[model samples]
Target: MPRNRQILLDNRPHGEASTTNFRLIAEDTPPLRDGQVLVRHHFLSLDPYMRGRMNEGKSYAQPQPLGQVMIGGTVGEVVESRHPKYQPGDKVQGMGGWQEYSVVDAGQPGALRKVDTTHVPISHYLGAVGMPGVTAWYGLVKIIDPKPGQTVVVSAASGAVGSAVGVLAKARGARAVGVAGGPAKCRYVTDELGFDACVDYKQHRDATSLAGALKEACPGGVDGYFENVGGLVLDAVMLRANAFARIAMCGMIAGYEGHPIPMQHPQLILTNRMRVEGFIVSEHLEVWPDALKELGELVGSGKLRPRETIARGLESAPEAFLGMLRGRNFGKQLVQLV
Candidate 1:
């Protein structure tokens, strides 16, 4: 029997993630059953949502169980099969996770896809045409529902999800304003993505100044808010929403760590008749194919561009994931397995 390496959650962090929280160990491969197929991982996606799973608390899904493989989405190739549905060399995508191989059941729903790489980069299944891409499309179309000529504000503007929202909003003829952490991301959002304006959130220490900065950026007031960070940035945006504004509550990266005591701004919602709704990608899966077609065309035509910060090898997964938590990586963070 051959053995494969798997990464497990050794411990949970208080505020941020570290290499010590993860344990990489070798495990034996059990025999494939009647309906299982052996998968060789090609790419493993590291997303902000993984941070929430590391904690032992409530979220959209149950927190990852202790001593178990850290759950994630991956694009893989079929190496062996015990099921009729799959054959060797078939490329597939699923929740195979951070490991060299996995025994996936072919009968399992959404096991993977037998795809050709000629259309686009195979790794894109974990990125632009994959989960992150679909996540961005769903948040903007199904949630924000932007109107032409309206102002749409996106936090973490240069990231995978943020970039998707900005491009889609602009395509709809809405004015897009990006809110990012530094000057580099600000430039990428405005210059590359063609956003109407951008705000650097790192410069402002508190909500008061942040709100003032946003006011300067969107003088007409914000008609749609695609929120990523949830601490002071969210508090600041609350102050500037236009009447009947719609807020697409995506991931709350700011609140993923220790619970920070943020100022309450529910009154803004009440006074403006704002509709702020929270959503997860799974809830909108039915509309994903349509979103993918739209985004795929944009990518094909060179109108929608995606940025990625790649790390080589499976061993570097822990480091790459930690760097993302600390705001160390730019664009969509990914691990390329060799």
Candidate 2:
């Protein structure tokens, strides 16, 4: 019997997710059907969105069921195939979940798409040149519509989606300002990521302090806001926003712990005449082709540097995920399964 190592959701976390919510197990790999392909996952994408799925209620997607493989994006090689489209040694991307191996149906739409690693690395298909990259494109291009010489502020600016948001804003001739958790992340955002400025949120925890920091960083007032970390960060930006400003409300990691994060300034939305919209990247699949093309070119040319904080193995995923929720990981979090 072929054994497959897997991680299943053991507990539906009531407040916040921890290692206790997950368990690792070994299972026998079933023989592939005629239309099936066996994928040996090389890299597993660990995203903040997975946190919401661990909860009980449905917000945007279905809640992750207990005693099953944790859901996520995976980039791997096709090891065995009884399918017509895919054969052995082909690199593909799929929803392979958290496992050493996965058997997927080749007939499924969006099941497996072969990727080109000649110009770009395969792992990037899980991050920059993939979901996070296109997500940044959709939020920036379709929602924010940042123009040259405008000031754009990105929350959680050193993480996967947020980091790409800042880079995309800058590429479009906007002054990018990032908000991160600590001084180191602040420095990385400014010095390395080439943002105009960065505010260390840890230094200014309260709403008053955060507002002051935003005031100094965005002197001309913010024209565009790419929000990934909600809570006080969202509240702070609203204080000094330019009239008719646009905000792409992405993720709210701060309130993901089942806490209510009331916006301190609802009147600001009215007074500023702001456009606030929230989106899920998967819903806007039409733009992936163009988004991926542009993002891939930037990444290939080293213009858009995609950073990763890779954890060693599958067992490290639970700890890595927990740490990521706490803002410990700097960039795209990945568990290198192979």
Candidate 3:
């Protein structure tokens, strides 16, 4: 058995998460039991949702237990298997956590899924063609549902989920606008990801100023919105939203650090008669087949090209995750464990 390296949640965060909140350890891999498979992880996904799990509180999901491996998605190869269904060298994806290896019970439904890297890369099973892509699809297709010529806006538009949202909207014949932090990110959102226009949120100090920039980008009032970073970004979008506009509340990264995010004019929802829906993608498992099919086709056809920012080594996961939370990553933040 190979030696396994893992990072565990050492403590819950008080205000903001830091590397000290995690502890790394090495352990000998246990022999696989009947119907068990051993996976040697090649890539680990670092997402913003993990930050929310670091705090002990009530959330859509259970809090990440202290002293346990930090929960995350992983893509890897099956090295050893006692299960009849799994064979050695098979590419698989699962909730392998922050570890270099995983022991999965193959009998458990959805515990391990074989992936075909013929068209889509295996690492992408954790990003564009996996959870994030499905997240974007559900928010935009189910909630926002933009029409042709309508303007759709998404915050954190250079990120994994937001980038896909903009492209998917454009495929539906809607004009996609983006709001990102820096000029480089904004440029990539427009030029690379094919967003119609992008607004640099850093240039604006207040929501009013940001809203002004949004007005310029979205000449036609925003008909649909995908909210990732709440706070001022959400405020700005709300100000420019058209009557009967739809808003998909995906994530509020701005308030993830135990901060209060008060809406300046929440009454705008009532005034505009907008439909605002908050959703958890996991809860909508019924849509996964349809969503993954469309997303897979888009990626395989070179229509939806998503980028990635990778950190090498398992030890790099903490800082890389922190950098992603601060918006330092260009695309999907991943840790290369191999």
Candidate 4:
């Protein structure tokens, strides 16, 4: 048995989450039972949705229980296994949480999935080619459904999900426009990610000001929208939206910390005749194979070059997660546990 390092949710957040909310502990790994596998995690994914889970209230998912290992996505290698289906040295991805190791019941469906890391890096199984990529695919392809020459807009455009949304939209022959916080991020959204144009949301103090910038970037009114950061960005997008525009409600990161994100014009949806749909990607399991197939092809062909910002060691997960919440991380934020 090996020593396993885990970060548990020490307490629920009163307002904003801090490092104090999590506590790190070390324990000896228990011997695996029949149909079980032990994985030494290499990477742990930090995502915005995890913030909502930390709260003790009704949400799309269950709250992160106090004094329990914080839930998250992980990619690792099987070091020991009693399961007949799995062998040592197999790379696998699962909900391994914020830990350096995981004991998985291999008999459970979707508990441990073997991954091919020959072309795609194993860490990417937690990012672009995994949940985030599938999220982008569902929001863009299934909800927004942009047509050729139509303009599609996404907020938080440099982040993992938003970056993929813009690139995926461009592949559909639609013009991709991005709204990011800083000039550097905006530049990366346009220059690196190939968005048709990008607006620096930090420059605009209000929705009207942001709407002016969006109008310049999206000469053609926004035909579709991928909402990641709600608040003013959503308002701005609505102001510039064309008739019958579709809006994919993915996340409202702006209001994640118990803040109210009121829409300036609630009547815009009716006036613009827009179709706004909120979705949880997990509920759409039927689409994963097709979505992963297309996303995997994009990554393999170098069409989707997703960037990552990794923090070293298990102890850094809390601070790295906080940085991501504040939009301080450059791209996909991960903890390198190995």
Please list the Cα RMSD from the true structure of every candidate, rounded to 1 decimal place.
1.8, 1.2, 0.8, 0.7
TM-scores of the candidates in the order shown: 0.94, 0.97, 0.99, 0.99
Candidate 4 overall lDDT versus native: 0.94
Clashes of each: 1, 0, 0, 0
Candidate 4 pairs with clashing backbones? none
lDDT of 2 at 250: 85
What is candidate 4's lDDT per residue for 1-338, written digit by digit as tens? 89999999999999999999999999998999999999999999999999999999999999999999999999999999999999999999999999999999999988999999999999888888999999999999999998999999999899899989998999999999999989899889988889999999999999999999989998889999999999999999999999999999999999999999999987999998999999999999899999888888888988888889999999999999999999999889999988
Q: Rate the local accuracy (lDDT) of all candidates.
A: 0.85, 0.90, 0.95, 0.94
Best by lDDT: 3
lDDT of 1 by residue, 181-275 (tens): 89999999999888999999999998889989999999999999998888888888988889999998888887776666465688898899999
Q: What would you estimate as the lDDT of candidate 3? A: 0.95
lDDT score, candidate 2: 0.90
User: Model 2: runs farther than 4 Å from truth?
Assistant: none
Q: Between the candidate structures 1 and 4, which one is better when assessed by lDDT?
A: 4
User: Which whole-number lDDT from 0 to 100 does residue 173 have in model 4?
Assistant: 100
Q: Model 2: per-residue lDDT, tens digit, 1-338? A: 25889999999887878899999999888999999999999999999899999988869999999999999999999999999999899999999999989999989888888999999999999988888888988999999998899999999888878778888888999999999988888888888778999988888768889989999999999999998888888888999799999999889988888898899989989898999999998999899999999888888887777778999889999999999988889789999988
> In model 2, what lDDT does residue 268 have?
86
Error of 4 at 72 (Å): 0.3
| Candidate 3, position 302, lDDT | 81
